[model samples]
Target: MATNQEEVKLFGVVGSAFVHGVQIALKLKGIEYEFVEEDLANKSDLLLKFNPVYKKVPVFVHNEKPISESNVILEYIDETWKQNPILPSDPYQKALVRFWSKFIQDKIVASFSKAVRAFNDEKEREKNIAEASEALKILENELKEKFFGGEEIGCVDIAAVFVAFTIPLIQEVAGFEFFTAGKFPKLYKWSKEFLNHSIVKEIVPAREPTLVYFKARYELLVSASK
Candidate 1:
């Protein structure tokens, strides 16, 4: 439980998967924190002050200290709250988890974003899709249990919030299909299981509005690409 002396708050925008990861971590640790929804078009001075380097949302402020980046915040939350441990206690297992989490962040998420952004160019989109699918295949081969964290949802699972939720929504809006069940059964199944988890169910943004928002962005991106 969080003490009254320790103040916690999250600065973020709605419909952001990165921000959602932080929310899930805090909830998993049963820490009560204030959520400050930032208007990215006109970012708040507080958010700017907290995360000047990146100037991004999902700036986690704890005890008047701010931690930027979603993955970093998740690690901080796990280290700060002893209960409901997300990272493994063993050093080797912990390193494996961190390795996979970084893989998801760097390869999986980046490849998917490239695919979405390459929507207007068929050849480019196909190339990006191939790269994205290849990344998913690596994760598919790595899964031997219910999650990347084995039996429980761990840091790697939380790190893959974009994979379970956001990427599917992006696929829908972008009219693409790279992460299908037939293509990557293990990863696809893991996504379904991850999304169905109780905490994930609560934290995931409502599908309808999220879709609407992404659809609008998709249109704008396509138009710009043209």
Candidate 2:
């Protein structure tokens, strides 16, 4: 299929938080791409073919070359498009962005488990909360300025926004709130501004639908635990 610009096809569900990162990055770069929604529960043959290792969503296939992992896809989108760039030109600055992105991904695992499963032990619950808090603190410091790096919405800003937006909904489902603005004032402010961005606003899923998604995931998680 010929695209107005060279065709770029992205495979993932709209509500997948990682997919949202790619969607926002592509929009920011003003890239024209076709979105193919995948049924994660069903495990599409295309996804399995493209990413055999993880077999996950948020797969970016550019002219048939497949790229998995959201952060990798973000980098690929920015580098390929070269229009509204996502990463900084400086090396040190770029490293800073990667640092936060990795941090967010790491904490996300623990947070997801905490959000989905029932914690019978107070010790385990405390451990999960501590892990989440540590991650949020790093974000708070990174967003001390108006942006993750400065006045503009850069790669780090976009990467962290996925966590900020999704974390609240996860908290809602878990019946716990770990992201207190009081504890992480800078991150809170940055999240408010990032979510308020016109591009961000356009792509953000409605809260109700997000909550429903979380509830469904939580149920599956609970069942898996049993």
Candidate 3:
């Protein structure tokens, strides 16, 4: 697809959080791009060639340059296209946004991955649950007054939306629930508001379907473990 300026392509899958992050960033920036869905179970040569190190999805190819890692691609998108800027212009605010963005990518995304599926050690699972809760609590507190950084849905908010959605799927698979009303009120409210937005609602897949998919996979994994 032409952006009336240059061709942009994003390689990723719909169910992936990282991929969703980049997609939302691009949409919010009003950037046009072609989205290529990869079958991660059967990765294509192009994906391997583009991201040899991580061989992960959510790789953004801009002007023939391949950028991997969702957060890195987000930064690249902000810098490359100055329209509808996601990060704050102020240095301190930018730092805060980046910090929470990294926190979500690390604690919520990476750490929760292990916590949900293929958890062999009971102790390890407990540790992961604790850590994940800590991260969620921090996010909840940060989102107490506003919808993320301020009144708008910015970089950190974008990341949080995916985290809130996918994390529940992870929790359901692991027989856990973190977004209880009493426990994470702010985050729960934010999640509701974020998912309700026209942009997010239009782009995202239905929650029940995602839950069913993950539950089946989780059941299979649990059976295999036993």
C-alpha RMSD for every candidate: 1.2, 2.2, 2.0
CA lDDT of every candidate: 0.88, 0.78, 0.80
lDDT of 3: 0.80
Q: Where is the poorest 10-residue window by lDDT in model 3?
A: 110-119
lDDT of 3 by residue, 1-226 (tens): 2367687999998777778878888887888889989998899998999899999988999877899988789888988889878888899988988899999878866667777764678787777777877888887778755668577678888877666578767686687765566787778878888877777776677888888887887888888888
Q: What is the per-residue lDDT of model 2 for residues 38-129, given as tens digits with 9 covering 90 to 100?
A: 88779888889999999998899988899999889988877777787889878997787787787787785456557345445667777777
TM-score of each model, paired residue for residue? 0.96, 0.91, 0.91
Whose TM-score is higher: candidate 1's or candidate 3's? 1
Task: List candidate 1 segments past 4 Å from native.
Answer: none
Point out where model 3 deviates above 4 Å: 118-120, 223-226
**lDDT score of residue 141 within candidate 3:** 77
Q: After best superposition, candidate 1 residue 30: deviation in angstroms?
A: 0.3
Q: Compare the candidates by TM-score and give the number of the best one.
A: 1
Question: Which pairs clash in the backbone of model 1?
Answer: none
If ranked by TM-score, best first, what sequence of candidates would result? 1, 3, 2
Task: State candidate 3's TM-score.
Answer: 0.91
